[model samples]
Target: MARSARLAAQGLAIGLVVGLLTLLVWRVANGNGKGVAQALADGEHPTAPAFDLSRLDGRGRFDLASLRGKKPIVLDFWASWCVPCIHESRRLEAARKEYGNRVAFIGVDTKDFSGDAREWQKKHGITYPSVHDGSGSVLTKWGGLPIPRIFFVARSGKVVGELIVEEDLPRYLREIAAS
Candidate 1:
């Protein structure tokens, strides 16, 4: 009877350990996608990863570190095929037009053809430069997630904010400017 009880206790302990591990993995994988405004409202600061990608123009490569000396950089990871990305392109073009020198805006086209990205930019009048992430190398470094993601980096090269929605963009940009 004692041996059976000991086995049962061991099983319970193992089950509890497995449950805890599963919970931890779930939390890590299911990150708080609660757009930037909501995260800020709850007092959270989202960070962006270091970025270095080749330019679509083929003129030169762009490294996040290179922009450190200049104004804050805003990066949008998107694709022409993404419906929401289409809307985001329009919004970013406006921001680029209004705050041209105040900030450096860039777009990273993920898993998309260069021609498609170029066409999308031309159609929307996007003045900012866009880099290609066809191999998803930059995306993996930037926390491999879905498209239409925005990362706001400070002038010092540190990421200060991350937003996942086009609707929350205006407020997110305002907050970034304030910060």
Candidate 2:
């Protein structure tokens, strides 16, 4: 009986340690230090995940496949409340001005309210269309673990570039254009 009690105590201790470790890992992985996005941009060409969501412009649904034949599209995952996203939005608007018909810009507001996203668009003078992924379902598929992520999908229907920093954004766009 004493041996059984010792085993039970050991099992409980192990479970508590595991639970604490998991919480620590979660905090580190999803913290504001730019985790998965940076690793992905530096590592490899992640498989383009299917993203289907409703456009904020009420122009029906926006499916990733449907934007294939058009110009290269940049799908930016952001939220209205994120400061970095605000900066990224300005850069995206500049890109739109520069490329015009040569490129398409789409913003996905993850886990955000529709009113806030719409207000942000108006405040920022964003001419491009945006969609809300409030449920984070599409975000998970796109592998967007954090806010302020950018995916540059080439005209040939391939995600050739991604950027995590505002400084690297234009460079990525230039690379996409050259490619």
Candidate 3:
């Protein structure tokens, strides 16, 4: 009985390992492989992954590809529940006032409800446009999780950099604006 139980346990462990491996392979096959953050860390400036999602406002959908070559973009990923996102987004709003004409400030409301995101935007006084990323699939491409991941894409559509520090915000904004 003891020997049989040990064999069963081993089989279950092997099954779990195989399951995890299959999931990893599936994600890689579906374009959910290495993220933009990893590519940046490896000294690569990849093209910003495109997404078309519904606007938090009642307006029509927003397509990232639409502005790809035409304008430099500041992509801000945030959720209503994230406290830190409030501050970061507010700062972006202030920056937008100065750079709005030259640069596009787009927000991706990741893994959050549309109504709440809209409310949050209003409450925080964030005037720039935002699209809902309820499933977080778009967020996965730009580097998933930890909320408030802001990236700058040049006019050429190449992702320039992500905001790593408070100082990075203005620096990236300037770089992308000039691109």
Candidate 4:
């Protein structure tokens, strides 16, 4: 009888562990783990932090405040060495082309060498302007590390959504466009 009781207890513990793991996986897959979706759902639209950074290709600077009221802005934080950034860069370029003048796309190259960032952009044939955040101060101001983080700011200068995964980016962009 004691042996049967012990086996039942072990099975219950295993079931609880499995349930917790499943919940975590579901939360991550549905974008709840990052709290981004929850924040948006709670009507917590915050103004995107302002920053002025030089362009990667020796071009002029990009001022966040300058983009306000002009068009919807898409800010993508990336690094040249991050593999996922490469894939997301292509998707962003395609989205930029599709959206045309309706939206403004800006890439923030954080924690990467200027030469490497410029080379990556050139190799990828990226035409959008990219800001250099070598010191990562801008990244810190916006949020912490995580290469390939994206923020969608509406025309009014309010950040509507944030995304970490590249796969969910297009859907988020579409939702922004629709808004």
Model number with the top TM-score? 3
Residue range with the least summed lDDT across 10 consecutive positions in model 1: 32-41
Per-residue lDDT of candidate 3, residues 54-116 (tens digit): 988869999999997899999999999999999999999999989999999999999999899
How high is the lDDT of residue 49 in model 2? Answer: 61
CA shift at 77, candidate 4, in angstroms?
0.6
Candidate 3 versus the native: TM-score? 0.84
lDDT of 1 by residue, 1-179 (tens): 99999999999999999999999999888654444434544666544455677898887888767776567778888888888887777788888777667788988999899899888888877768999989777765665557777777766665666675555566656655554
The residue pairs found clashing in candidate 3 are: none
Candidate 2 stretches greater than 4 Å from native: 1-42
lDDT agreement of model 4 with the native:
0.81
> Which tens-of-lDDT digit does each residue in 67-163 have in candidate 4?
8887788888898899988877788898898885788899999999999999999998788889999998877766657768788988888888877
> For each candidate, C-alpha RMSD in Å?
6.0, 5.4, 5.5, 10.7
Each model's TM-score?
A: 0.68, 0.71, 0.84, 0.72
Residue pairs that clash (backbone atoms under 3 angstroms), model 1: none
lDDT of each: 0.74, 0.77, 0.93, 0.81
Model 3 CA deviation exceeding 4 Å by range: 1-31
